[model samples]
Target: MGDNIRYKFDYLIDKGFYWSIGLRSSFSHFNKNITASLLLNDTEIDAMGLNKIGVELQDQTNQFYLQTLFRKDFALSIGAEHKRLEITSETLATNNVDEEFVFENTDYFSFYSNLKLDTYDDKYFPKNGVYFNGDLHWYLYASHFNKTFDAFSIAKADIGYAFSITDKLAVNLKSGGGFKLGDKTTQTLDFALGGYGNNLINNFVPFLGYDFISLTGNSYVKAYAGLDYNWLKKHHITLEANWANIDDDIFDTGEWFTLPDYRGYALGYAVDTFVGPIQVKYSYSPEQTKGFWYFTLGFWF
Candidate 1:
């Protein structure tokens, strides 16, 4: 609905589970770049330095997918994504050739097959069950004929388990991992653990020990465990802990944000309930120093 973001959603097939085919498309654009100084505390402290770092990035991505469920617990999905990324410099009041910084446009393409299984007691909110998802994708450099980055394969899997511990308490666990077969990879293709949705690795730690995104790499393995109790109607209290580590490729990158030297095993608390039409989750993390505020999106339960 906004100029910065444009999106359209449509289901080629509207029938329920009995139906076997469907199509979905998504589009988005962004105006994101280093508009401010790294030392944000003083934006104007170094005007020229700030302008030197002023890299305006225009990003647009269009994605579409077709999926069919030919079997009871399996779905075969094929998707294609194209990205047009342009980088430019915003030379502020002073226009000096040396001060301007820009990079060549990048055209990225991805094609993939995603298979999902839903065997949980409940898909959206499960009390006791198991869920597994696996996907493999191919990243193709369509715009470059140099062959430096022709193509590569990446595979990822997620496994989750939940069962009751007592009449009043239950335990839940989830593990995820991934690998890239080809040695060639771009920073954009790197893996990360944090933020909303599936990126929430550990229940006790949010934001990769700082913010909602961090601890990135080409390969990763993470696990989380927690006990939940429901004493009130439609409300649960959870206590949990999580641990995660990335492959050596992370250290090889030598970039802290992309792959920071981090230690997992943080503990936290969460309370889950529905407040009117919104799902409310309150999580508390007492060990992180990167100013990780508790996310209200997900809980251990």
Candidate 2:
């Protein structure tokens, strides 16, 4: 569990120019103690000296950014960020688990530029328009613990479009991807892809039917399509499908027709309540043993 702190200030200027500066910081700790057989393959289980292994992780990040927007729909921002991670792993050994695996802490600094565009008709329920956002980061410096690269670059973009198909039906399509540039990079720059909820920092992408941040990759391409039908003025039904290809290597070239490694589908019903919208959904993934049920209030993040 962890906590996040954020502060921001905004200034308005002439000719539709909007400027703001912000700071965001967070800290988290994770304890991973599990039976080796549950997570390891047969070969891995045999190699492990302990029947159970445990890992403790600590993560922290601090970021500062100054951004400006021209007109109303497009904006650009630049920021600097520092991130640190420490991991310690324990396992049993022949001599009473004397041996332990400890990885050197990883700490790094980066400068990033972000651009965004949004023309959606509604923030809670978009029946028309498009949204686009992109980010580019250059890792120019790092602590001595980082032996991977002196400098590298990462780029990411997300685009979506929604349109009304009929009096009470709408179609929504979205595609997003990211990759590392340059020959040298660090695992710290990889993307974490899974789950769906509010916006997340540090290259986290929301994909339905999976556990939160359950998948990691150096690069990825994902697409989503959904149909929303308003059978009644305040009641709705929806169907969704998602597909993606996640890779450990940087930016692979492929067409959407190429078979993807991940796929998921969901059906949902929602009602607009006095306070917000209440939704119930059932999601399925072929890779999983069974489907998942979700119930939520307010707009679907």
Candidate 3:
């Protein structure tokens, strides 16, 4: 079983000033394996054996922010966010076999601001501009079984630029790297993606870019490329193909579990074109070792 809860608030202080806040929580439970026994003609015999497992997961998040538009060409903003996650799992067996339990927790804090320049409509470059965005974040994560605790922190600064290639196309580029400030061994960075759309599609927009992370300390690089397309004025589709390969001896440290080696493609689609404000979505992830599929439906304002 799984459940999630979320909340958000937005306020307009004035024509040029605004504030927003959000929160989220989640939980999950499941079972893993089981077994049974029987006897025939007074002779004991193994009737059936099964593996059953269960999982319970939970998450919570909160955010608050304020922004002010100083002029037609400039703006300023600030925000803070908080997040938490908890997970638990259990396994059952027969013949008096012992059960297993696992737990993990994570918490994070973030503060960010941006000074943006507006260049949305210029005859020479109708959809282009430059901006400077910066952020500071702290994270704390622990695993009960491993008896390990990680307190990591990082600060980042990014320079973003956008240019229009034509009335139908535009490109954006951002390149910046962050430095680890706490008990960590690697540097983190911020990247950007580019998107394109046309008036006729009104609902269909497509984008492509690389979202990547490098762990030089662990000697591994992970990256994903994908596209998001909208349809039917209320439907959305996303396709992401990811790849990751180990390059160093760090895998021997058992930390390899934190790395994403799925190395496959995933498709996700959602639509809100139903009556009574209902929404539906589906997803599939096929892997070399194991695979899974999911579906969801809901209604909201």
Candidate 4:
């Protein structure tokens, strides 16, 4: 985690109307470091070779919008956003000289819309109903590295359903994906999948067994199936499986199933405490030699 400052203001049009106007702004910093043995075509070394890679990103964003009430069951919002982004990286590119750090700044203006619907019976432990969320972004102007771009778009969605099989058992299913269209998209703007928590501003999704933001691509589709057994009112046991395909050209090819790249399995136990839920999960993936353990005190802050 890094520095972050965010604020929002809302004005209601009328006491009984379900509409509001809002203004929001935020400034944040994010950093990531990676070390991996990557090869191109399974033969030659990748462009950055086999070295530690570091990235530091800073962003300032402001938005003005009108929206339906932020209700538990349904909501809609349309907004215009302006963003300033700066990125600095080391060992991410090679110049064949002493210079190892690279820096760039970009600015973007876009129109976006968001829709959400949720009918889950419970927030922490849902045993019935479904939920859906979708977003669309259309960029009207972008300036990066002294170059300009217009007419870029991004679309993303997530849907989930949960139901009880027996009084003590429940099942949950979820699927989500996204696409980035237009050329010269920045690295940090790509959809990232991995880890156990979400950073919505950066489009970071959680995959059980991988490192934080480890998988990156222009397009991806992922799904999860899980079962929960309530041993008692406050105790639960869970099992889950997830599969995903992440690629730069996923929609253009017929290799979706033939190249199912990432898969994970997990088993977990949870206790509903007075303060919050405590979760302990063990997860495994084919790419790892050992299983991973995750512990969380609450859902998210």
Candidate 5:
């Protein structure tokens, strides 16, 4: 049970420059990302496999940001955010490396900036081109019972490439990475390997693949490759695969069986269909919360 809202306004300055601002917020019941990781040593998963409900996932977030663009999609932005991660049921401390026996009602305040370099054939989806996006954020402060957050930096990037493998088939690849610069960072700020969503926490991906894999550590990287089968002149149905892993691992104390490292993969089937002039994605990933089906439309911001 969750909802998301985003608002954006842009003001054009002359004909060459414009300023844009955005506000976003989202809510979720049991940690926005009801991922397979939620199944770890889970006494609840035994009774409800992925159907685990009425658990501690309650969380909310809000972000406000502004940007300026001068030419050719080259833009920059600065923003601040507020996050509340309250997991009253479970402890995030794995293998006893952390002593926090419970996930607290931690509050975090962050400041971040973004850079977009769009050189692809299309902004949303590209057929034969490349695109790259970058982000740098600072964890200004936070209040957690067992955790401390000072000034720390996080940098992340996403790279995409699409090309023709054959007349009937096309290929697209994506790679993303996130790393922390400070020695101490919030658990929410740690780079996790699996589960969906982009740069922010509100955009969480639910459970599906590898029973548990959101291994948070110093750094994490993931890659995806998709092959499209052209059914129409300008459209194609795609089959994609992804893999991700973290640099550090969770040392097991043999307390209970769980994935000690964040390393997993997923296989996906998706098709791009059009609603008039817009693209709609009707897809299925055994790697998501609703393991059966999901769809992404152009207007779903």
Candidate 6:
């Protein structure tokens, strides 16, 4: 079970000057039990285990972005973001022979930036120009609870191009890699399995493209394809369904998930609309982890 929430805002002045900001926070709890039995002729044995786990997580993030137009056909941008994450976990387990209880809490923070180039005239692709882009990211992560764990600072750079293949299809591709800036805590924790401290390595993600959507309005469909390359090459595919109504946007409700760097299967559905300068969205993710569901509500202005 989980609860989460987030708030985001962005603004563009004089058509080319841009500025934006965002924030988000969340929590989760979990439990499970299992029993097994075996029989052989006149001999029989049985075993059972019960596990209870509770996790409380909180995350706060802030971002600022500024982009300036050098001319009608060119622009330059700079942005910065800050994130803080705090997590606490408690577990109780019992088996035929042993019983145990565990508790842990961790806090982490990161800061990063982006630089990009835009070539599109901000029109329909077939009638508009193409966009070529290159950007670099510098990030820092530190954990308060675990110091030996290497604090991390890394930089990544990427180049890509985006254009509409047709009136209904468009695509973009980008590839980037990150390396540690200095000797820092590299250990990570696995909360779901109740485990601790694991080495962290540099990460690489590759580029791919797809047709996102054509239809717009009360209902729409979007699809994406991409690949992740780190320890091994992993393929990723996504399909999304969206629907809306008059009284309220069905997509505007719930809490946002706090974990951001996780790779797993996810499915979400929501409805949303605008109130003044604010936009609100709500989504539910089932199959988050076996029999678990996550709900998130977000507001953007």
Residue 27 displacement (Å), model 6: 12
Better of 1 and 4 by lDDT: 4
| lDDT against true structure, model 6 | 0.30
11, model 2: CA deviation in Å? 9.7
Tens-place lDDT per residue, model 1, 1-301, is 4665555555666344554444444444444333232212233536345522344545555657777674766776788877665655554433575654444367778888888877777443356888778888787765762235557777887788988867667778887767676754343354655533422211112332333334445666666676667666556665555556664344345432342234443333434445321233333334455434344444322
Kindly provide the TM-score of model 1 when superposed on the true structure, using C-alpha atoms: 0.65
What are the clashing pairs of model 5? 29-57, 29-58, 30-57, 31-57
Report the candidate with higher TM-score, 3 versus 4. Answer: 4
Q: Would you list the clashing residue pairs of candidate 4?
A: none
How well does candidate 5 score on lDDT at residue 18? 60
- What local distance difference test score does each model get? 0.54, 0.72, 0.39, 0.73, 0.54, 0.30
Q: Candidate 4's residue-wise lDDT over 68-179, tens digit each?
A: 8465456888999998877666655566565545445778889999998888887667789998999898877777563635476888899999999999999989999888
Candidate 3 at 256: error in angstroms? Answer: 15
Off by over 4 Å in 6: 10-57, 64-81, 90-111, 118-143, 149-151, 157-179, 187-301
Q: Write the per-residue lDDT of candidate 3 for residues 1-301, one digit (tens) a residue.
A: 2343334344445555443332323322223121111001112222323222244544555556666665655566666656555444444333445643433355555565556664544311224666554555555543343244456554544454656554434444444333345553221111111122111010111121211111123233334444435444555565555444332333455444466543545566656544422322222333333333434444331
Best-fitting candidate, scored by lDDT: 4
List model 6 lDDT by residue over 146-265, tens digit each. 545554444434344445444434444333222334442231221011110111111212111101111111111112221221121111122222111111111232111222122223
lDDT of 3 at 130: 66
Top of the candidates by TM-score: 4
Cα RMSD (Å) between model 3 and the true structure? Answer: 12.8
Instruction: Give the residue spans of candidate 4 off by over 4 A.
Output: 1-18, 34-45, 50-52, 69-73, 90-104, 144-150, 257-259
lDDT score for candidate 5 against the true structure: 0.54
Candidate ranking (TM-score, best to worst): 4, 2, 1, 5, 3, 6
Model 2 Cα lDDT, one tens digit per residue, 216-255: 6668889999898999998889998888887655355554
lDDT of 5 by residue, 1-301 (tens): 1354334333423333566667767654433343333323335445445442222545667778877774666777788988777665433334666433355577778898888876676443456887778888787777755355577777777888988777777777887766667644344445544443322343222222433224445555666776777666655565656655554322223211243222233344434446422333333343445333333443333
